[model samples]
Target: MAFGFTKIKSSPIAVDFGSDSIKVLQIVPTNPPQLIAAASVPIPDHARTDTISRMAFVSEALKNLLDTQPFKGKRAILSIPAFQTIVQHMAIPGNAQDNIEFEIGLNLQQRLNINPNRMIIRHFPCINVVKNGSTQQEIICIAAMKDIIMQYLELAAKCKLDVVGMHSEPVCMLKAFEQLQCPQDTSTAQCYIDIGSATTKVVIAHGSEMVFTKAIHAAGEQFNRQLSVKKKVAYCEARQARIAHAHGIDLEASLNNVLAQSQGGSSHVNDISAQAVIPMAKNEKTLGRREGDKDSIEQETIECLIDEVQMCLRHYHSLFPDKQVQKLIFLGGESNHTNVCQQIAQGVRIAAQLGDPFARLARIGLKNPPIGVDLDQPQPGWAVPMGLCMSEANI
Candidate 1:
């Protein structure tokens, strides 16, 4: 094929290998990024724990998705799942500033008892700290084993895809909300709480700079287990029930009944009854629990999650006493439950809203949008993949 003066550019495919599912996305690089194609495949229950099985499942899913979707180019960026990476805050001698990377590597080697050369390390310098009157530099360090990186690369190669960059979930998540950063007001801190399948990630940032991050053990899977135990049902059944509750099928049915009454010209039916399905204000102190067997179980599970998030916020406030998180932006698969999010916001005493990565996207003209994904509604689970699209190649 001959002859173009201008080089054609396409964003690298963003692959988010989540614990519960594998999400693949690509966007046209433009002023307001345009959605090109997206697809998601759930990880089978049998493959969830075993590494070999999981990898094999991912390989097959990725191959099918790429071959079927309208994704352009083969280059892709991957997000290392939160559970697979080591993220920590360390204090090093101020004198080590000149060779921070080397010092961090040595420190990690000593702490983890692993070969520094066998790990890929990255760090972000934070505010200095004084311990016993001696000044020290504080930094957030992220590391992943070389073997795990190679495994991902090999998977991509097998699928005939080129792996261009690798990023941690926290980094990719922050990148997804770049448009929300307020350059003029750098002091206003914001918190992002991503409730994923295995773990929850809490990221605190002041404007565009990330200051702190933590991964909580409590998340969606825990919720499912709690529901399973409470209901005396199989884990898979509980998971299905949880999904149905999140989608508000019961509420939808009630709304449909109200609409039917209004269409029959009943004077008793009012607009307020129809709008009652919307979640209450963030400041509400309690959720109006439904009266039934499922009510107590759902409430207890949400309370447990809120407790973990509250603890994380307290820890962050202790470290950065001067900076307070002004807002909470909830993302990830579990955030689809509006009632759960509202209760957590109430428990944390912070104004919060569900994060929508596609909110700022230009007129979406997706050719093959993933099943069950509605562009008109906020898709919080797509945050990591969308952020990857906005990311630059680390290589």
Candidate 2:
């Protein structure tokens, strides 16, 4: 009998630099991966203008987050921002395996005007294709500008952290789903809809391999803007209202101050107008229409989101005619909306549900989770960072 069995462990952190915030996660590399520390902080507006300033701002944020928690190590894997990267599908001669690198470089120059030398290009094998009456291999190519990668490295160095590996946001997202559900049949396809603050990344994958991907430039923030315009409320207030509506809560009653402010009255109501006071005192329903109006605005916003998602599905089908997306898995911040998830499922006529990465990890025995973290709840926004943590040796 082997008398010595010691549990192997590695502490690796994952930092996701998103458009709105920086999310940091430290995980102990175990079978299920234990959460050592986690923090999310907003990215200041001024820091977003340029790369140098943004890198400095991110470093500051990273220092603050790490300072607030007890993360094990300084080594980290960074999630390359989607805005700074691009994914392309290239068709090349199927038999050109001898000079595949040259073929890939030529295709990049021809299609995207991207010099392979200036960018880090990685390819994932996709299904073979028949185009122009000739057989070709379709490969998904991910490229991130060298400068962008350096920016992240610089940030890590400034934060006194070691950069171990880097991955695109979409690939990290797919990796999270792979741990969540393992498709028994390779032909069964699943689509991941990661609705973030500014963009919605739609990724179609069979098993752990990504087959198709698209980013809807308009997503959660777009809905917030529409709510602000239609509901005549401040952007912050509209964001809250949109989130409540997504949870299937009627926010009309709670939005009294916002409605009052919209009508040229102080939200605090020190000196109430006769019209405003009369409604509450006399039970007039005039202000109640605003409630109905809010509902209508929500419906319109959700419909637009559904339409965009449907178009993405159609595009995926157009390219891969034989593959059908059997399930829809929602992720990112906006996917927390139950109504949004239900509506998209109904609109697309597919089985839809939210992806809970935490719960998936828990099944593998995530130890010492943050004191109050509810593994049952679906946190769509944590997909990327969590997946990044899973990139370590044993997670």
Candidate 3:
């Protein structure tokens, strides 16, 4: 067994288990990577919070997707949810004549209050520091709860899938973006912000190697909820409004179009709701601007998001000042929102752009992608699964 960390020989499917949805992908390693197949499915409401419920839902969903989709592979590399993993940076004495595992176990036990015997610990070695003429290796530690690991294993077995290896979400995203596009100057650093439905993942990487990774509770859900509260509307309606606002869709124009259709005795009015027809409410507070502006809703919401990103950036720089981030890259479904992208760039004071993991890959149109997939444009959320497949395919 590879213990879910070692690479396997078979063509491994990349499965990203997220809080709201599951993304699956498989690719063939080529100069320009070939997309084998891809799928995304929403998580059921009953399985949102309970572990066993989630596992059961996911197992069933995986089996159904594989059976129906064009994906080919039995082995898989999974993305460990950021919330389930404990990540930290530590320095261990180098040039020592001692077993490294023993040192790591002792450090974790003393520092993190974690029992090494009950956790599967993995470390990625980073640049070494010279302290008092002694070599000290700086490494990033990732530890997962043993029971959670077992749940994933069981889920894989239930689907009759071989679990080849597992990696953290931040790592997978970094790998996928690096393969797609990265600064040619290895010395320069870049930041990756993956804004999922319920959580946001921040990663600072030098080239393909990550120096820092963190998970924040603020994400698309928070923004939507804020919009709902501020606008005094239902959540589903608020969600539609926020998405439309972010995409710069003129609500008034859309409403006019609908009215024109309705006047022609079309059934468009029946299909459109009052919430979607109305424009976003103004008079909401904004960041770095006067109150009651039309864009205030978006600006104010993104202010909270920017605060979290700044915290992560401060922490990253505190540890590695020399590796200052040169640019910001946004991933995930929320990254498609133009307003979010612009606000993040202005808030971070760094040039920002959306990441395309399929930038260098073969153009596989969105004619028949897996259910819940949006191939009309670049899907930055697929970065995790794509990166996992790249790792398995060794591309």
lDDT for position 76 in model 2: 84
Angstrom error at residue 45, model 1: 0.4
What are the per-residue Cα lDDT tens digits for candidate 2 across 37-139? 7677765656655767777788887887777677767788889887777777777798886777888889888888888898987787777778788888877
> If scored against the real structure, what TM-score would every candidate get?
0.85, 0.80, 0.78
Candidate of highest TM-score: 1
Off by over 4 Å in 1: 1-8, 109-115, 251-295, 298-304
lDDT for 185 (candidate 3): 50
Which has the higher lDDT value, candidate number 1 or candidate number 3? Answer: 1
The residue pairs in collision within model 3 are 283-292
lDDT of 1 at 333: 85
Scanning candidate 1 in windows of ten residues, the lowest lDDT window is 269-278
At residue 18, candidate 1 shows an lDDT of 92
How well does candidate 3 score on lDDT at residue 29? Answer: 64
